[model samples]
Target: MWESKVNIYNVFELRSRTLCYFGVGAINKIKDIASALKKEGRKKIIVVTDEVVYKVTGAWDVIEPALKENGIEWVMYTGVQPNPTVEQIDEATKMGKEIGAEAVIGIGGGSPIDTAKGVAILLEYTDKNATELYEQTFIPERAKPVIAINTTHGTGTEVDRFAVASILTKEYKPALAYDCIYPVYAIDDPALMVSLPHNQTKFTSIDAVNHVTEAATTLAASPYSILLARETIRLISRYLPEALAHPDNLVARYYLLYASTIAGISFDNGLLHYTHALEHPLSAVKPELPHGLGLAMLLPAVVKHIYPAVPEVLADIYEPIVPGLKGIPGEAEKIASGIEKWLFNLGITEKLSDFGFTKNDIPKLVELATTTPSLDLLLSLAPVKATKEVIREIYEDSLNPMS
Candidate 1:
């Protein structure tokens, strides 16, 4: 019935083309995934990661041996920063190009993987630099293949074509998605995620929750995407707290990782909405704020604002998280309130003001959000039309969420 109603529009597409290897020992299969390129005479590869991920997780210890054992020569570009910037992308791209890497292997969370996608984009569009790439001055038709080895259970960059890179000079963060940037393969091993710090795990899990929430509520959501989004929310609601409480619980980590990948696919097809659009400006201006934290802070306001436009959709989404609350009147507000409580329980009770965002910064955030070219698609996909006033109102609400 939901499908019949939603599928009335016959002009949409969904594609999950990434070859995925999931489970306990998926990391060991990297050499097998990379061998496909090596067989085609692509011997050299670049591993894109951050310094913190490299030393903390011992990712290199597992990945390097696999590459060397399989005779795949590789170089390392470990300069990726959180909320990765164009400068970081350019730095990694230059390193990748100088080494003549035929492919890129991303071995961290979303930032490094997204940076790797940017590097792969430049590898093909040799004429374009990171600035031009983020500016949309050049549309790439192809890129060197990428292998994503996910170390965090967030961002789903491992299996999605989308990549978000920040341009600090412009005070903008743009999410770039093209067919060319999709990783050819992905490896999701829960063992790799067992040691994730509580803060990173908490925020990243929230990021996945944000992905599903936005995808399910976006105007572009199809019946299929909603189903996936619903399942993602269910898994996260049940498993994320357990994962946070017991970091070594591989079962919890696996479900969260599974939920994240499903959410990524859901959003990749249905797209995101104003919540993501609003969060981008915050992270772009204050690159230190974790993306999921910003999302958690802004989500309740965005949901409340958009609830009137899609009451049925929000009701369906909330039913799984807060059982027996679906048929009640004002369910949207209840859901919004429930989300705030959940975030507070997870230790994300801080407001935007706590992060140095004063009311004076509202105008700048609104301007950047409204003017950012990359967010046009998501803005259009939002259930409620976000004008400058609406965006400012959301930012103001985020300033004191508890109130």
Candidate 2:
């Protein structure tokens, strides 16, 4: 009898740079972490964070004591802004250089972590400014080591090798993903997250869900990414409400942190699509609007537009949240509506109008979104191809979701 032959041809890869520590007192391990990484003789470091985080959480109180004990001299750069701008990056970089900093430790949410990554890049490519750096006109061969301490369970900037910075002169917020930009290590302490304002908690949780939803439905999604995304969705769906209802609940906070980390990893591997594309322009144009809030407002509209293209993936995404909803007629709309309701229950019922956006702003938003170079790639990965007209329609729908 002749033997049978079989051949398989599927290839995929997942990459993560940060070694993550998660738990109640993970923040206390900063001393040991700094000691281990300091073997390279880089003792002087800069802690990048925002003034609000530094003051409100007293993250510096926890981090500075550890660094002092470890004999790791440090300076502070608390100039990071929400949706960090290139000017902030330049300012922080200049401070880091002035202090003779060797490593950059980010101690806040995405903005500070991203600022640290930008500072790291600029530290190496000393000749480049933020504009040149973001324009990809001067790419550094390597960045100074970055250690991220996450205070928010959003952005996943802690574990991923991507940094989003706004170039205000150009009115663009570009996401820079380079191997060197990844944090050397990440500390995610749920205790740090417990004090988050209720609104911040709600927005960040929704942001994590958006990450998983976009990643799971994108063309780049693999079986591995799907599995992670599924678990992330389930975890956020179950625990976010609990965390909100009982702010002191450590278990809920831990699961929310886990969900954020897993979602970050999944989307870092699979990438995101229209929801991110739409939200970026919203924030770039109106710098005060939080990224997660924009995503929450636009997600349902974007999902409805894309449902015709990736109904199966969308159905699977919602199935974990709304058990037994898949395989039913009009399930996609139901899922989208359910998500909107869930967000509403969490007190995130604001529309674009609440953020100073009107129908008159739609065209400009559509223009900004469509012209974004990265958005072309994101839209390409989206299950549904979004033209400027379609993007405009999504923006219009987002302005009045109930209509």
Candidate 3:
């Protein structure tokens, strides 16, 4: 899809350390990861998860058996919820410390995995807690090794070095990205993903799409990022609909899983900008809001704002979804409105107001976007810098129907 790219001289730096396995039967490899840990005399582990996904995905069927056979005793911490909070991370960290679990396994989507990342830090820095980890001043350089068993098709926290947790009292959702959080092992089994609910299939897949979009256009954009982003967009555009129609179709689930994985890798190297920087605030203010929905709400407006600065990159990556308009000039609003409609067609019919936000909330969203810990750093990566006024415009433009 990035046929127009011709920059051969821009320097690139790609980074990832996780040993990841992908396929229908890859979950069994957890046996290998666990057995190696057992050899190291590490017998205790904390399984961080939201209660439902672990069992519903049948991941527990594989993980429990593997851990038991490897003589690894586990403590279960199931308090994680969507847009995981500091309180939840601290609760799990306390349980993990009580058991002296030396390593952590995260099972489920981003929330559980992100909580596990937070727990991994608090476990090593025993005196500190999740509150300190999210304070934005402490950049953790060392953490207990994490093993990620992914159950959903989006938020490749399994494969990426990013985690997020909220400080509810401060209405802050701060994301932490560090080399230390990269999982020691990552398992992405498409078989575990076929059972995903229809809404989750849509929401999670859209999150991956947003990831690729931002990766292709962020100021950190590289040929490596663009290459992965193109293939990710192609696969998701072809497969997300089929997965939604036939939730049990393994082939569709397989490609979507790969799509999400590559999308994760794309961002790991390319970084992110407006969509994520802005969406975190929406969920922080309403902690129950689905993260993908928040991204979907802001994505079109964010794209509109940055399109002029990186038109070629935006056009290249969006070709699969919006055809015949790639190289055209003066089509920012068209692409923006088209994506907004596409999201609505995928069943996310609710607007920002539908989620109880209004013009009154614009100032608050702006405040959070510009002031949230590392989010300002992300704003710096925008091709078009996100000032307070620009942040407000994106939030306001997202408040209602643009079509």
Best by TM-score: 3
lDDT of each: 0.84, 0.82, 0.89
Q: Which candidate order results from sorting by lDDT in descending order?
A: 3, 1, 2
Backbone steric clashes in candidate 3, count: 0
Q: How do the residues 1-105 of candidate 2 rate in per-residue lDDT, one tens digit apiece? A: 000111123355687778898888998878778778567888888889988886666566777777777788877888888899989999998988888888999
Which candidate, 1 or 3, has the higher TM-score? 3
lDDT per residue, candidate 3, 70-118, as tens digits? 9999999988889999999999999999999999999999999999999
Clash statistics: count for each candidate: 0, 0, 0
User: 267-363, model 1: which lDDT tens digit per residue?
Assistant: 8888888888999999999999999888888988888778776766666766666666543336657767877887888788988988999999999
- The list of candidate 2 runs beyond 4 A from truth reads 1-10, 327-330
Q: Which stretches of candidate 1 lie over 4 Å from their true place?
A: 1-7, 327-329
Candidate 3 regions exceeding 4 Å error are 1-10
Candidate 2 worst ten-residue window by lDDT:
1-10
